[model samples]
Target chain A: MISKKKVIAVGAIALAAVLTVSGCTSRTDSSSGGSTAAAGAGDAKITVAFVPKLQGIPYFEAMNAGGKKAAEELGITWLYQGPTTADAAAQADIVRSYIQQNVSALIVAPNDPDSMAPLLKEAADKGIKVLTADTDAPDSVREVFVNQASVEGIGEALTDQLMTAMGGKGKYAIVSCGETAANLNAWIAVQKAYTASKYPDATLVNVVYAGEDQAAATSMATDLMNANPDLTGLVGECTSSAPGVAQAVKDAGKTGTVFTDGLGTPQSMAPYLKDGSSSASILWDVQNLGYLAAWAGDQLATGKTLAATNDVNADLKGIAYDSSSKVLLLGDPLVITKDNVDTFSY
Target chain B: MTLDERTKPAPQSGRPAGSSTATAKRILPLPVTGQEFVLIGVLIVLWILLGIFTPAFLTPNSIQPLLVSVAPIALIGVGMTFIIITAGIDVSVGGAIMLCAVIVAKTMVSVDIPLIGAVALAIVVGLVLGVVNGVLIAYGRVAAIIITFGTANIFQFLALRVFGSSTVNGIPSTLEVFGRGEAGRTLGVPNSFAIMIVIAAVAWWYLRHASGGRHLFAIGGNANAARLVGIKVQPRLLVAYALTGALVGLGACFILASGTATLDQSVGSGKELQVIAAVVIGGTSILGGRGSVIGTVLGAILVQTVTSGVTQLGWPSQLANLFVGIFIIIAVGTDLLRERARRKA
Candidate 1:
């Protein structure tokens, strides 16, 4: 017969071993199932993942927080995850991983339009609703792009701003982040055409790339300032470039002479706007962009077909879908100057 | 020590002590050979070929930018060589670079610290991080690879927490100039390249002639034997890691100085792999005990050439990475073959 003490010892050892293995397995299982259950709840629950070109940017993080607010209000599950870096391969891996987890819908701001096509196509094939927001993968099979503004609208606005700032006749320059960035390039092309047609007297002097890096943007801005001392106005096409350009102008003490404006956050551009270093900055409500993305995701996930006249019920009422382009355009962008700077939060 | 006596052939008569010493020193004057020589030669040939094919390849304007672009990466590769030589690795270098850069940028921008103070603080952060890794490996008795892999995530999280999601700009112009400004021209040559040459030469001198350097090799060759010889293995290992960390910290500052440190989650992502590839291709044995700093410099140049060349050729950027992957495999394969031959001989 086994002694009672030996039997108790064996029992304790067996219990510890089982608990240890179970603890490991359960940790993995619970983490995996947590999001799944969150996605599966009631009719109120809509799962939407905002896949930015990459993760961990203030702009994207702000947008994700905005999206989260909408999710909380609508009782939806919002998953915000993307590649840590802005590389096509990493983005592709994220797409595959999210698909395996079977997210109800996906909204991506693609890094490379063509490189991400196959993966986006795979998501489409899986009956998962995919939308492109912020940046488009035009060649990809993604449906219903949520545009902050029309490409032509952004182009026309940027050109008009430059023309007015330059008094409709002066040599000016543009600082862009990348040549291949579809949205920025589109705006540049439109501005170029506009400069030729509308303001023939206003010459387009030079265009430089800063690679979406702020330091590079600052350097390029400084270079432009040094290269064209008589340049009247500057347009920065990326968020990071805009603030850097504004700061460079301010530091160079050419604020009044060289009018500056572009896409920038209020927090970054506020000082420049107030100090008259920058004339204006154009931006949309990043938070509202997130809200609309979730609403669109819900519409597609619920078998509701998108139409031009269809009003998708959103936290902010009346989100219209343009069936012609399968695109949902957000409200107009605000041109934040000293007058209106206080009105916007982000 | 007389040159004439040193040059004289050992007499057919049995040689005395002086001749025997000379023979021993001459036997392996160059410790590296075979695959290492071939790898360096190949890289040199490619540089010449690219210069011929690309019109702007040899121009100061084109090449200066390439050198600037490769500087930060080359610095990291230098540190990685030491880690790899010790029969261990640290994949956390990229994250460590990011963390150090963020710390420096934050200190400069928010704390309003002077440039010197910020740089010193960044180096200290890197050194502390290296100590953490060393302690975990030496005392905790964990695998260096596993410890570093985990530490990468920790460093990334720390960076994000401190810097937030916005790119830090408006770095002091003085710092920027150091990274971007052309060093003083000597005979019309760029000063940055000259600085790199100096760094390479010093590293070579230390690795070749220093007693501490020999101890590093001995420990790498066999830890047990090194301990038996009372070499104080753990402290040396710690020092090697700390040195690498300090170098990486300097590299990060250069990168930030090159451009504004964007709160990019991917700031140093995938860079550790490239550094590892460079060290491996430099004829460094992955399992430890042997590496040359000059070979590492060549490796960095080769990697940089491929990246710039492919882009200039208008090929897809993906092809650049693919070529690196291929080169790494071929490099390691050749090293293995050479080792096999040496053992047989």
Candidate 2:
């Protein structure tokens, strides 16, 4: 009995020792994996990985679809993943895994730009080409930013479209997602300034944050309308809240009375646009934007500098790339009304 | 405690049991509890203040939508109050709602199911999830939070897999009868909120007057002691969790109705926190000895009021979170103090 017990103890120790040795080796191996790949053969497929703010949402999925298409056309491996929620730490984990996998190029639409700077630097140091797409990490060591539309582009479009519906507007409020989202805040800033400059009669009454919640956006839009009885317009500032604001107007039995235009996907905004609750959805072609990001990542990976004007494809022609600031510009934001909503499925 | 000792009225009843022949005289508690009274008072003060500040706040347009928003949370809170009463918590309702909403939304679009059929499907799916949670926690002897937290992630993954990486668009508005639209109202009251009130009333009575209800209190107070006295602890816990799942299914339908025509992956995001916040603020003890469904109903109303009031008053929407957090702390603080005082006495 004592001999059997000793054998069991010895076996357990052997197993623990074996596991400890293997774990240490794998740890060192992964750390060195990135460096070796950066210096290794050119025969392998050029891998481009893009991580969005969140996965499974229509906006990002369309981007993923575009990225996949670009991968097929360019003959490179396109790896796409993101945190299920637009959470920074979770995004960072996925980014780190991609970095370890030694993907040739890494792209991120960071949820938190400030926190992502160091991680981007770490990837850069490992010799992996790094870039930002959709949402930029301005202070990071990224080589390029694949921008879909300028802050002025979306903001002016939203304001202009809603003003047209409101007949140059009376009072408007903005329902935005993510209180601290950099891009949304920039757009809101532009909306505030543009509304003030362009339309003398239109007033920006309030801007509320709904934190990527469609239902909260709807309820808040209702409250905004109630708060300002004469309020004629609302801008749903994110994909989720875009339809949300329109739903609020419809539910309140004030469809034509209150005009809403937001950054909504076409399919989601189709119902509202047809019903006349929402005037227009101002957004760039999301899938095309994704395709551009993957293409840019490959360009950076291959050490090919983008020209001032480059033809990407038939759908994406004469795309502008600013060499000094490293920003790749996808042209004007597309406005989706009832007439054009069905044309773009994503 | 012996069977003789256990047969006596629970301390929560606030009176000795079997002391008189008249069953009316042995009524467990007053129709309302102290926490509920306080909640009612706070709600009144806030409403009056909101009415004064925002002239349109008291109108049907504003109030009707507010009630519509509160319906789902309170409806789910009824089941949550039951689970908390049995010393259990289900934080997976958010994920459960996501799965149920997506499934129902997909079903409604593809199968063109009617309102009754849609609702029934959601409830059954939710019940199955609840049973999965209940069976693992109740019989497996795992902590409720640990099990529910793990299941929450699992449910989210399943929901995401079902989504297949796209939003469920063009959802038919057949469920609009429970929405905030014109069809969702009856005689000036929102149909969804009215239904929630009826359900809450039934729950309030059951928790206060039923034998099964008292057994839940006993089990929560001490599961082993209750088991010794012949209360089926595991089954009781199972029933509590399963009941919550069923309510979550219905709540998801209300949520879908209240939302836009498109259903996205974010459909039920952060909803568990909202429902849990409402339940705790409604004066249900987190530790699980004493609570009321009325308090939960009122609590949901109060939370929604604060959210709507903050927006109507043109205050930064983040202030609503701060106010709800303060309310939860105060409710739990007061509960702890009361518990301490009771023990000392």
Clashes of each: 2, 0
Model 1: per-residue Cα lDDT at residue B203: 68
Write candidate 2's Cα lDDT for A22-89 as tens digits: 33433443345445444432457798888888877788989999999998999888777777667777
Q: Supply the global lDDT for candidate 2.
A: 0.88
Model 2 CA lDDT for position B269: 85
The CAPRI category of model 2 is acceptable
lDDT of 1 at B65: 48
lDDT of 2 at A278: 94
Instruction: Let me know the DockQ for model 2.
Output: 0.46
lDDT of 1 by residue, A1-346 (tens): 1432453465466556644543343234334644664556445455777777766677788788878887787677887766555767666666666777677888888888788788888888988899889887777788888888877778777778767777888887888876677788888888899889999998777777666666546655655665455778888888878876776676456778988888887766777787776788887878888878887887788777766654544435565677767788886665777788777654
Show the lowest summed lDDT stretch of 10 residues, model 2 chain A: A22-31
Task: Write one digit per residue (lDDT tens) for candidate 2, span B48-80.
Answer: 999999969999999999999999999999999
Q: Where in model 1 is the C-alpha error above 4 Å? A: A1-55, A68-145, A150-285, A294-320, A331-346, B1-28, B31-55, B182-199, B261-263, B312-316
